[model samples]
Target: MTGTPEQVDYQQLAAEIMERCEVLGRISADPDHLVRVHLTAEHKIAANQVEEWMKRAGLQTWTDAAGNVCGRNEFGRGSAPALLLGSHIDTVPDAGKYDGPLGVLLAIAVAELINNSGSGLDVPLELVAFSDEEGTRFGNGLSGSYALAGAFEPAWWDYTDADGITFRQAAIDYGLDPDKVNEAARRADELVGYLEAHIEQGPLLEDADLALGVVSSIATGTRHTVTITGQAGHAGGTPYDRRHDALVGASELVVGIEQICSTGGTIGTVGRLQVYPGGVNVIPGRVEFSLDLRAETSPQREAALAEIEAAAAEIAGHRGLGWEIEQFYTSHETACAPWLQGAIAAGIRATGQSEAPMIWSRAGHDGMAIDKITDIAMLFIRCAGGISHAPQESVTVEDVALALEAYEEAVRRSAAAAVAR
Candidate 1:
């Protein structure tokens, strides 16, 4: 693999990525499942393994204060801001092998090519294997990126995991000084821009029969925990007209959410629902459910959410039930920089994908966090069946090959864009 754009060994790169993914896949907390949570021993081992690989690729590597595995190809350019490239290294419980780790491994592969090819880009490249993007351990995603962006909230130190361990304690256990975690923050002026290569985690590219695509924007999402309360009664004694069934009201709201989101690109999901007492012979006294709403843009998502909320109110009122909705998570839509978009498109073209389609990511990514500090862009490679976060998630070697070539080209283009700026 030479440094020249045309000399990349796509097949070899693809094979290496797959091999590395398998190796990391084995370092899970559960022997029966893949669950690498934030700041866990399993996560530490995975991060350290990647750090060694980064060093092997001829870069200065270190585990950041936030537990992120960071590597930099400085090219001896003192104080010149570097182009940031990477993706999360953490995974959701029982997650697929490629979702987060693939991006990091691919980045390292590209760095290896650049260093071994005897040619380097004008601007320096920094690779980051973010420690905690899934938020599986602490329920707060982007922990690593947030630290890097200098936006980490001190209040999160009190955040606890399922095992009753505080985030600060976990950090300390992971060999990171929680008090000095801010040291992980990178100044805005020190980064030219950010780019990430990831699995599309959707079927669009596979549907379009394309190997690669550039992201246009990331979808905005709103999540709510809803509770419908009503009087409880014996299932047999309560008359239909007299009954104020919370479950019924919740069911109506669920139907309303589905009907409202069916017409547009907006999506709604009721992922969790719980009935009070879970009794088979009692009318439900209360019902708690979760609603996840997303759209290509924030306004659209907000509009749909408003409609859903109104429908919920109407259903609760008609059913003689009291309702409460609390929004717990919200993320704004993030658009890729125009220049980086063009650069990614150029990379796609260089990989023989002349008519590269621009797709919007419905799933959240580290780019959503990094966007706060600098311009961000994403390259999505096709995955099989659009399945992710599961054991069945997969990508073809052919697609991986194309992604590698396009990714390498994109780095060169990103470096050039930084120089131009």
Candidate 2:
């Protein structure tokens, strides 16, 4: 991005990126070699593997209060603003190889390239392999980044996993100081920029025949639980109109909620549901369900939730039943910076693409939280069939190389800009 002639060796750099991926895949390959690193017992093994890998990469590593691992390529004592590149290594219960590991590996690969080059570019670079970014533990996404941004909730500490392990204990066991968790948050100005490389998590890039797609915006989402209460009676004893059937109420509201979200061109789902004392011969006494609503923007998503809430209220009131709703989580959209997008556009053209559209991320990512609070952006490489979070999640060696080029170029541009100013 800055230097002239042949300061960077693209071939060797690509090989290094691939090589790191290979080692990472090898060390963590457990059942079917899916490379899953959940926040459970396997987490200790996973973090140890990652830290050891960083050490092998000739980089200095440290863990923050939130369990985020930071590695630095320190060049000089001038305190040059850094180019922060990272993604989470933790995955769901089962996962593909490329989701979070690729970005972390590629960041180290980029650093290797810069270190090997005999150039004057000495801009400091930092690569992070964030802990708890997947939110697999305690159902909280972006745990590390949220803590780093000072947006972590105190209640998160009180959260006990299914096995009854508190967050504080987990931190302590993971070799972090539980008392200093809050000190890990960024002080509002320590970082210069951040970048994340991730799979598209969809089939769009592959369907459209593209090398890599740059992210434009992330969607805001709201998760709410709805409960309905009604009188329960024997099915044969109660007439249809006389029975205050909670199951029927819930089912009707489910359809109405579906129609409301769909008709408004918003995405929604009844992701979870349960009927109290579920039985075939009994009228339902209580029903509990969850609604997941998402939109390209916050206001739109909130509006759809309002429609769903109103629908639920009407359904409960019509049946002379009781109802209540509780919000689970709310995350807003994060917009990519214009110049950064343009810079990545230049990187895309460097790979001989005619155009690359700014695609939106439908699923929740650590990028969503970081981008909203920090100067962060992401790159989406095509996944096989756009599949993610499954055992079949795969990316090509060729595409990995292509993404490496774009990632390095983008990082170089940003780091060079840091040095320039």
lDDT of 1 by residue, 323-353 (tens): 9989999999999998998888998998887
Worst ten in a row by lDDT for model 1: 1-10
Query: How much is 243 displaced in model 2, in angstroms?
Result: 2.8
Q: Give the TM-score of candidate 1.
A: 0.98
Cα lDDT tens digits, model 2, 1-421, are 1222265555555566666665555544365655444445566566677777676655678877777878776676356566678888887665666778888887776666665554424466777888877776678888888877777777787777778888877777767776787887775355667888888998999889996988888778888888999988898998887989898899999999878887886789897899987888888999999988878888888788888778888888889788888897888888877656666766777767777768988877776656645576778888999998887888877777778778877877776665554
Output the lDDT of residue 376, model 1: 96
**For model 1, how many clashes?**
1
Best-fitting candidate, measured by TM-score?
1
- Model 1 scores a C-alpha lDDT of 0.90
